[model samples]
Target: MVLLVPRYDEPRLLAAEMELIDQSFGIAMLGCALAGFILALGLSIGGGHPGAFPWAVALAAACALGHFGRRAIAERLSEARAGLYARGMTALLTVIGGLWGLAAWLYMDVHSPATVICILSLIAGMSAAALAVFSPCLPVAVGFFVPAIVPVWAVFIATGDSAYLAMFLGAPLYLAVLMVFARNYARVARHAIALRFANVELIARLREQTARAESAQHEAEEANRAKSVFLASAGHDLRQPLHALGLFVVTLGRSELSDKQRQLLAHIEAAAGAAREMLNTLLDFSKVDAGVITPQPRAFRLQPMLYKLENEFAPQADARGLFYRTRDTTTTVFADPNLVELILRNLIANAIRYTNQGGVLVACRQRRGCAVLEVWDTGVGIPITQRRAIFREFHQLGNPERDQRKGLGLGLAIVEGLARTISTRVLLNSRPGRGSVFRFALPLTSQAAQPADASAGTPGTMPSRPSLHGLRVLVLDDDPEIRTAMTALLQSWQSVCVAVESESEALAALADFTPDLLLADYRLRGERTGQEAMEAIRERLGRVIPTVIITGDTAPDRLRNVHAGGAALLHKPVVAQHLHTAMTALLSESGWRPEIPRAAGMRMHG
Candidate 1:
């Protein structure tokens, strides 16, 4: 007889079952094999009883082989959900194993000898039932009733003898014990089935929740994109009329009209400008939120721009009964111009807006090689409790007698984004109803600053204007009035102006014209934007023209495209001086320095 041994991996493979029925089946097979081996060894002390040994050997071999085969069948059939086949195979093999055990008991004639074998079979079946945990209730009924009736009927078959009677009497007790064990096993299986169903339901619910969450996330992204689109379309549509209105307003300002009428016109222009500013802010915020506005770092004079802000805002503060000032020595910094403008505009605007009956002081000084710019105010301060919360969108606080509609509550938020662009930040210091201070440091330039302002101890500075005298200018816009206005404005500064409407018109003009500058509107006809149009123009010009994208579109994506075009950007209702300033600054490398001061020729009020 072969002494078969199970491998460790056998248990590993079978252990996939949650209830481990395979484990129970393996243990039963092992028990049967052990009993058979004992039977073979016990029947023959030496070579005296060869026939007995052979009989025992056959039984032992059958038990071991049947056990191994049965377990294999169960494992294969379990995956197929072939419950009936598994039950039949288990019962047939288990009966054989029990017979082998019974023969061993009979050979030895141990008192109540069949009891051990019967108990062994019972234990195997019960263990299997217990581990199965979730079998149908009908199967549990069949397994218990069939086995329980077996010994009871056997005792009745030999009822004549007194010993037989005793066995028959004890049969009912054994049947009762099996009934109890089966009921308990069934209960466990039922409970396990309940838990399994519960788990399945939970997983289904979890999947549904995850799907909804993903759908909501997609919707949020779409909404943000829609917002950007709406802003762009609205801004573009309004710009044509706004540009016309702007020209008319300027003309009206020059009319021999009443003081109140002039003031009314100024108010109209101011309101329009403020609306335009809000639109731009929204556009920038959208681009930033969409992760398209990247910092375009370049070397520029920080002090000059800072000083310009101080001078620009001082009159406004004075009109509001508030003082405006700044302090800075270092001027040069390598950073994005657009981002710097965004930050400084918001910070200074806030200082002036918030300060009442007090002064706003903006100061900058050289720290190491970097410049530290600070804005201090003795204005109505931020509450200590709400200092952190103030940065949130649309959040505003109430003072003793609060102004209902103040700023858009996006000042500090814009400041945060602008600071990130330049790698310079706004640092805040404030006490409720006392004052607040906002400061940020900037990197210094390698070139030494001119000596006049080093020891002068002043931050307010008049902007140093550059000459743009013989600068060749090309302006492309769809509107006839805007093109005429641009041409008139540029020619007055001794700059040649060739204004066109479309790509075809521009090409025709280019045939006779070799201009030094190309200023184009971002949106042109025939599904072409300024970026593409300028690219074609640049190719024809055989040089990267100092191009500027002038547009009124406030869409995040459109603005992003303009920024990526590597051109200086200007948003409309364009003032002639602002246009000239942008053009001169960009075209100054061509050595076409204009002698006349363009700002001197224009008039404006804060």
Candidate 2:
């Protein structure tokens, strides 16, 4: 059972109770002293005991002075030493109680019943007041009331009269009752103090818990930032060597070789391609994880995007000896075009990679006010149990051997991420030993118009060797291997190439060589960037040259910087054909006409 009254065993709680009693003691003492003086003055004038009046006044004055002195001492002491102050006050109250009892004894007379009654009443009142004032400390209350009432009882019993004897016995009983009441009151007060302290402790614990939670949140944020930094640094470093290797491979492909040498080179290229795919997949996953891939939703016809995918994957399907088909639709989709394209590209690529015998089909249909775009592939379908697992990173169906040719299994993961980013749901329908269908719904928009033809302009056909005859190309890159490989590639295309490693070198080269194009690396030696170099060179040349910034860094900030620079950006380990296409497009847009001329020598400076 819970006790309504608790023990005052806690030192802090005891101190608190003592301090409360101390604060109120002065007022209570003053009230008692004034009452004593008034009773003494009235008794002296009425009963003709003028000598007792002086004694009573002196006792009352002493009591007031003692209380004030205790208060002064209490003010100088800290709460931690309140026990000492409590003891001193208890002794003082005991003395005051004794003095009150003495006055009662001295003033009581056999001749005057009124004086006896008056003195007895004053003593009883003082005893009752002690119970109220000293109840917080039980021992102090006992000390006070015992001394205050005992002497009065003694004088009455000594008279040996029947009435006085009865009064004497009743006085001890009354004192005993008041003492019990004081002890009970003290118990209840201590219980309240205990609860107050408990609440304080509970509040303290809550503050500590809140502080710990905030600290943990801060640590998690710091770890996430560190992870982003590590990924950016690792991606940049990895891409640099891979970028140089790709350039060397392209240069080697341009040389004469036997059938065996050609086959070996093909193997090398395939291995490099697999590595590049894995790297790109990791980069995409990081971007999604970092929340950098934001959707740019717009209304556009779906047929053109489907046609683009069909044309892009046509060559791969033909190489694999599988038919590829796309059903044209006039449906319009309201979603981010680029994010939708990324999702579709991954789904289509996965379909092509897994299918061996049958074809892949890209189609769209209407469903409940939305366009359901789907990719159907006749391949080794996923089992029901493993369907949900396919969209997880590094999860693939029947590729346990970890074959690079089968892919790193990040395609479906990317597809799911991109789909979620655009607030679209990707659904799968598959059965073992049959085919599979991957589909997502896009909200239909009535604002888009149907085109005259549903064709993504024919996929650009990169020439076996692009002709840059009589054109001058300026190349800036910090890496010597990249510079040399680019110079060889451009020179092979019949262009006069000027390769330099720094901004100062490129500026020096530009004094004699006015190039038609500028291909610079995004990150160069020291703090200078390719964008800065391009702007500086253009300003010095007094004309805007078509520029392409090649970057190995997949960091979001660097990518955004390159994009904002208003120049075409090519990521590291760029395919030779893609680079050629970018150069040709820029040159054509600038109205640079290729002139049939003599072969130009490659110039390397700085």
Candidate 3:
């Protein structure tokens, strides 16, 4: 019922207070034993009080009996039992206080003032210790303090001496001050317990939230992995047909046709090209995430790459009625030429796509021993808030309708990914409507630039077409449409072709024919892969033939496996010119020189 003890409705707080009382109960009992023994001995020895020793011994025994079984009582403590335990402990404490008061009564008749003062001093020490030990529960502390010292005050008043009466009057105020101190101490202890419980509850809730978050993250990862698997499977299946379609269109282009037919064919080619570009973008993103794109840095002239990009994007810029310029520089930077060229190409293309009224600029300069290549565009500039988000995969600004013309929104993402592959970071500076500048720096090298390939001019420029006539080529693919299209395309170039549907058929073709080059599709029937077929053929021939692995799978793990085989890889829906370039380069390395017919110069367009 005391304010220091929480109400029964709050069982937890009440139980906590009772537990505190139990903890300090032993201290209270120990103080009682010591004070009782000392008081009784002092009275008997110094004041000749004969009965004090026997009385003290009996009370001490009773106090020890009450202190026993405390631990057992606490173990089974409950709300109802807590009240009983608190009342019982207080009762025991009050009985001990009465023992101290009895010592005062027994020693009051002592003649020696020193002996009387000693007894009073012993009683005061016991009451002060009890106050400290039981203050957390005010009722127990008050019970002990009142009984232990009030009896001495009574003795002082009974003497009727002026000094004793004065002391007794002040004693009540002293007790009242001690009671107020006990009350404040008890309130603070209760608040601390409440805070402790609140903190414990908060910790439990936090742990639960953390567990839920971990579960959600695991599910998200699973869903992403499933998505990658779906894309990889679908991409391979779709690329087979699309690859055949592009090759068939190229074959149609080679044949004689009217102007209208040619114009229609051009439209089909453009549509197919667009699809191929989108697929390639996805493949590039997957390769970067899969950690398959390793940068091969070397010294290469920046001017040649810039020229190639201009050639590539000039027509688009012209159609959009936006001027495109490239500032020429002899800066030879150290970086993977192919990756750097890809980064610049994406930036230039993105700039041209967004700009409607102003021009785009591609420039390079030397700074801090690095080549700071920049693409500046007077287009719809990116907002400051969207700058960082633009680097995230598939995130786009101002094109929420998901228009195909605006691209798949992967250009900047790929740009950032490729830059990271080369151990560099892309920097962006932009305004809302004026323009945007994209920049990244590559380490510059003093080494001489590698000799530019005579056959490999600028990326979009075709230097010359090498004759594939009289060149023996072998192709392995599972899809019948792909095999038929590939045979027709290779034959159109005047190259002898043997296209087979399986490895067994291809190996059978070798019985009467010798092959100069091998083209194998990456994924084949059953658990077999193109790498296995290539290894088998090479082992049988006892010589390493020039081989290229053409695949449509864009999954990161598949890319890593294809790269690990150390074969030249070309994605599906291969542009005719790109295929020719790859095959021509491989054959040249194998010392196969094609005899070019003395005809007008022919350009094979993709």
The numbered model that scores best in TM-score is 3
Task: Give candidate 2's TM-score.
Answer: 0.71
lDDT of 2 by residue, 1-606 (tens): 112132333557668778668767777778877877777786778887777667767777767776777756634345566667667766777787887888777778866888877887777777777777778877667667877888878887888888666787898888778877987888888888788889999999999998999998899778767756766788778888888888888888879989999999989888888778777877787667655677877778887888788778988998999999999887877888778877888998999998998999999999899999999999889999998899887798888899877887878888888888999889999977788999999998885444233333444344464577978889999888888888877776778888999999999887788999999998888889999999999999998999999987766666666778978888777777878889888988999988878868778876
Better of 1 and 3 by TM-score: 3
User: What is every candidate's alpha-carbon RMSD to the true fold?
Assistant: 10.2, 7.1, 5.1
lDDT of 3 by residue, 55-164 (tens): 88977886787778555575435775776676777777778778777777667753468776787677767767766777777777777777777877787777777856
* lDDT preference between candidates 2 and 3, better one: 2
TM-score against native, each model: 0.60, 0.71, 0.83
- Sorted by TM-score (best first), the order is 3, 2, 1
- Per-residue error for 212 in candidate 3, Å, reads 5.8
lDDT of 3 at 16: 76
Candidate 2 at residue 22, lDDT? 75
How does model 3 fare in lDDT?
0.79
User: How would you encode candidate 1's per-residue C-alpha lDDT over 574-597 as one tens digit per residue?
Assistant: 654566668877766655555454
Runs in model 1 deviating more than 4 A are 1-139, 142-191, 247-265, 286-341, 344-409, 424-472, 491-496, 511-514, 538-545, 564-566, 593-606
Highest-scoring model, lDDT: 2
Instruction: Provide the lowest-lDDT 10-residue window in model 2.
Output: 1-10
Q: Give the alpha-carbon lDDT of every model.
A: 0.62, 0.80, 0.79
- Stretches of model 3 off by over 4 angstroms after superposition: 1-21, 37-115, 165-170, 173-177, 180-224, 314-323, 328-330, 353-359, 365-369, 399-405, 443-463, 507-514, 593-606
Q: Each candidate: how many clashes?
A: 12, 0, 0
